[model samples]
Target: MTAEDLSTGHTAIGSDPALDSKIKNYYTPARIIGTDYTYKHKIVWKNAIGFLILHLLALWGLFIFFTGGVGIKTALWAFFILFISSEGITIGAHRLYSHKSFTATPLLRGILLTLQTIAGQNSMYIWCRDHRLHHRYSDTDADPHNAKRGFFFSHIGWLMSKKHPYVIELGKRIDMSDLEADWMVMFQKKYYYPLYALFALFIPVWVPVQYFGESFKNSLLVCYFFRYLFQVNGTWLVNSAAHLFGTRPYDQNLQPVESWFVSWLSFGEGWHNYHHTFPWDYKAAELSMHFNVSAIIIRWLEKIGLAYNLKTASTEMVAKRIIRTGDGTHYALGNDDAKARVTAIGPLHPFNPSYTTKYEAPGANLNDQGLPLFHEMDVINVNNKNIKRNFTKA
Candidate 1:
């Protein structure tokens, strides 16, 4: 979390002197944890209004569905789109990209990226960056969705509220050179506005309305708006419900928990205690596809040879940790782990300081391994060097 903590083990990113200068010269020192870190809860009115409108439209969408206006095929189509879109975040952004729990070919990456775009989340680069921040500095002022702040804050209020100062600064400390090296990720980022519209909004609705003989109004509400809110909230449940209301059977000290309901809703990402405990495990849980649709889809992709290098923790590893920290039964307070973690101690991803140049880089940790990197996050350094070289040349 300290500047020194981030700077270690990282080589220069872009080979261009000017670019390196730009990054090194920019950094502002700031307090990590104190009363000053508190903010007045500024509301992002633009997003708030948009969400309000979407919720209203979703109500209409629900009304029509229950009243028999939507057909079975159209309903199924909406759900299908919803599934693919959610996968983009779960399998694509969260597991594949952020955690590096698995690797994907360009083809699989394209498919996941397309599905994620349909979900209407931010571009994968931004999504991965924020997720990395959430893990490395979890349950602190820096966590994008700190559950300690409250269920509402972690669930959706964080989005409507202006970002806390540390959230913005600590985010820059995350290592994202891997994403920068991805052609598809950069392509989507470069053209995210149109891509989000065409894929997330336009294409999804167009497919059903054009081919399924669905009405525009009905399809628009049911397929796009309502489905979007539902999908986003499903992802949010991992941030909110999983954190607040489940059993930390794996590690009773951490805030994350194992919630079967959240797992079902978020497509297997609700195994919170297991996930935080063994983050590199590709399954996100001990069981692979049981109640985890994302793991099922990932296994299918592996069968097709589009995914590889899937990482996971061993039974031996889990058993040792469980005996050391958990009873493998349920979460309870007043345990040894809890008393030790009374303050929930962790590495601080404070803002980087000591930039001697004029232009301030976004404070990207040239060495920031995005999140904790656990037992994984390691990749082909040779490829990164080549990519950064090419990037500088361009």
Candidate 2:
């Protein structure tokens, strides 16, 4: 992932003077064009075929188990593949690469990149580009997968349509400078398809067939295709079901919500609201909350000197931005407040009124005004001999 490799087909970082001049430009948004505008029907057909075959094989696997042709060991292996692939997307691609929530060593990066490839999504460059756009324009038309566009649109329709201008020029806007600097990322990007073919498909099939006496076809069907399909859709569910359903634990400003069930399925990534609100935080689950398995894995790598700079939202910071509503009053400071209070004055200032304080109602509770408030403080009047003179001056 040399700088040149990442910069190819994309704008060079901080190189375009015209683009830099318009950093604050709001009237004319940047546009990407040139690629084919419409999705090929064949690709859709192939995707459908892949999904259908996966389901068919899963049902067949159940039948085989019932007839004693497949044992619990085989079923567990298939399940493991599904879990790893899903985690690879959620933890590796989404959190680590796209969000830069943490850092990983070359070896850890290789493992994650390989697992992500097996998930059969787009390459890291493409995925990261679309995801950055999604965060930048969430719930807007510009968002690649805005649930506001409808469940189907966000779930998969965006992939099928060529209506988005940015979709065509995806590589242009995304800055993959850090990733590009690493040789492993470049290697993965260059050989992703072959790696997927060898490791995800061939290896999974060959290993089981050789060691467990399982048929190659059976292993490919159950362990590879079936697992891939399940993992892909489970990841997509975060874009679709997570946004459409569930409660908003953090920012109601955005549509994406938090779902415990989705978190369970997506390895703590179902906490989408929290994620959107705090993109740099490694643990979307927050403290004492459900442990984020992805964060745990990153931590393990760091513990063994394979990862570094594991970013996380502080407890006070997360708490401040976490929405809690009661009695028609919405609480929770926005990200701006959280950042200012935490980063500027330090985390402890939230409890120190001299440094930080929220607006308080004099007699009645205030309604939600998109801000956080603390208890009212009483004011003291100082006695003065010249009170009449001061009143006359006023």
Largest lDDT belongs to which candidate? 1
Using all chains and alpha carbons, the TM-scores for the candidates as numbered come to 0.77, 0.68
Error of 1 at 363 (Å): 27
Please list all clashing residue pairs in model 2, or write none if there are none: 1-180, 1-186
* Superposition error at 165 for model 2 (Å): 2.5
lDDT of 1: 0.73
lDDT of 2 by residue, 1-394 (tens): 2456344434455566785454435334444222232533223555556556666886775556567664567778778777787777877888788876666767877788888887778677667767775665555444677566667777776665554644344325455676678777778788878887886888777777888888876777677766676677677778887776644546555566655556766777877766766666667655424636776776677779887766665555556566442111122344444333221134343122122123221121111111111111111111111211111000
Tens-digit lDDT string for candidate 1 (356-389): 1111111212222233547223322211332111
Best by TM-score: 1
Candidate 1 Cα deviation (angstroms), residue 159: 0.6
